[model samples]
Target: MNKRISTILLSALFSVSAFAAPTSYSVDPTHTFAVASWSHFGFSTPTAVFAGAEGTITYDAEKPAQSDIAISVSIETVDTFVDKLTEEFLGEDWFNAAMYPKATFVSTKVVPKGDNKFAVTGDLTIKGTTKTVTMDATLNGMGEHPMSKKQAIGFDAETVIKRSDFGIDQYVPYVGDEITLRLTTEAQAK
Candidate 1:
C-alpha cells in the first residue's frame, strides 16, 4: 500500500505546470482527478470522482493566452461509492457508458484573470452533446519539487454544468440537474 501511494505521488509530480517558457505536461492519474456532485433528493449531495484523466497541457508563461489544453476522462471510471449507483450511471438513464465512453474538453481560449488565475473557455463534449463551458482556474503553486529537483506546478479549477443540457437530466429537480465539477492537478515541466 505504501509503495502504491508513493508511485501515485511521483506520477502526479510530473504533472506540475506554471513555470518559465512553453512546457508540456501530462496529467498524473494518481494525483489528478475530476469530481462531480449534485444535490440528492433536495436534501443532500452525492458525488462521483473519476481518476485516470489522461491528457496534456502546454503552458507558455510569456503568452498565457496562447496556452492550450486537451483532456479526456473515461466515464467508466466513475466511483460513486455505491455499486448500484455506479451501475446506474453506466446505464441508459445516465451516462450510457456503453454507447458514449469518454468525456473530453478542449480549450479554445485562456484568459488570464490576474495573479495566476484564468478563465479557460472551451468545448465540453459528453454523450455526443457538445457545449461551451468556462472553468475558473487558479495556479496554486509553482517552482521546483524538492525530491525530483524539477520545476513543477499545481492548480485548482472548477465549473458547473446542467446535466439536462447534456441530455442526462433524468431526475430533474428531484435529483438535481446541475453538476459542479472540481479538479486539482499537479505536473512537471516536460
Candidate 2:
C-alpha cells in the first residue's frame, strides 16, 4: 500500500511538470520587423518597413491558446523606400508622427488553429485610434538559438487593416485604403 501511494504521487508530479506554465520572452528588436504594403493607384504596390519593435510575448507550447503578445513600433522607423514619401507618411496628412510616435498591439485572445498556427485577436492602436484585429500567426521555430545559445522562439504573422480606420486617410481609394501588415519576430526567453 505504501509503495503504491508513492508511485501515484510521483506520477502526479511528473504529469504536472509536463504541463508547465507559460514562458515570457523578450522581443529581439534587431531580429524583428513590421512591413506594410498597399496598392498605389492601381499601378503598383508600395511597401514600408518598420524596425526596432519592442515588447514581450508570453507563450505556452502545450497550451498555445493561453499565450499572448504585446508590442510597440516607433512611427519614426517607418521607411517607404522613397525619401519624399516617407516624409509625407510622418506628416500631419498621414500618420502625424509628431503627435503619435508609437503604434501598439496587445493581444486579447489566442486561438490555436493546429499545426503550430493560431488566430491571434488583438487591439491595434495607431494615431490614438484603437481597433480590434485578428492576425494569422504561425510559430516558425522554437528552441535554443544557434548563435545566442538562448531559448528562443520565432513567429510570422499577417493581418489586413484599413488606413482610413486608423485616421490616416491621406489618399484614400487612390492609394488603397486596405493595407497588408506582416510581422516577423524572434524573441528570447526572459
Candidate 2 lDDT over residue span 1-190, tens digit each: 9999999999999999788888999999999999999999999999999886999999987888889999988899999999999999889888899999989989999999989899999999999999999999999999899999998999999999999999888778898999999999999999
Q: Supply the global lDDT for candidate 1.
A: 0.86
TM-score of candidate 1 versus the correct structure, residues matched by position = 0.85
Report the Cα lDDT for candidate 2.
0.94
Best by TM-score, which number?
A: 2
> Judged by lDDT, which candidate is best?
2
Off by over 4 Å in 1: 1-20
Query: What C-alpha lDDT do the candidate models reach, one value each?
Result: 0.86, 0.94
Residue 77, model 2, lDDT:
94
Stretches of candidate 2 above 4 Å error?
1-17
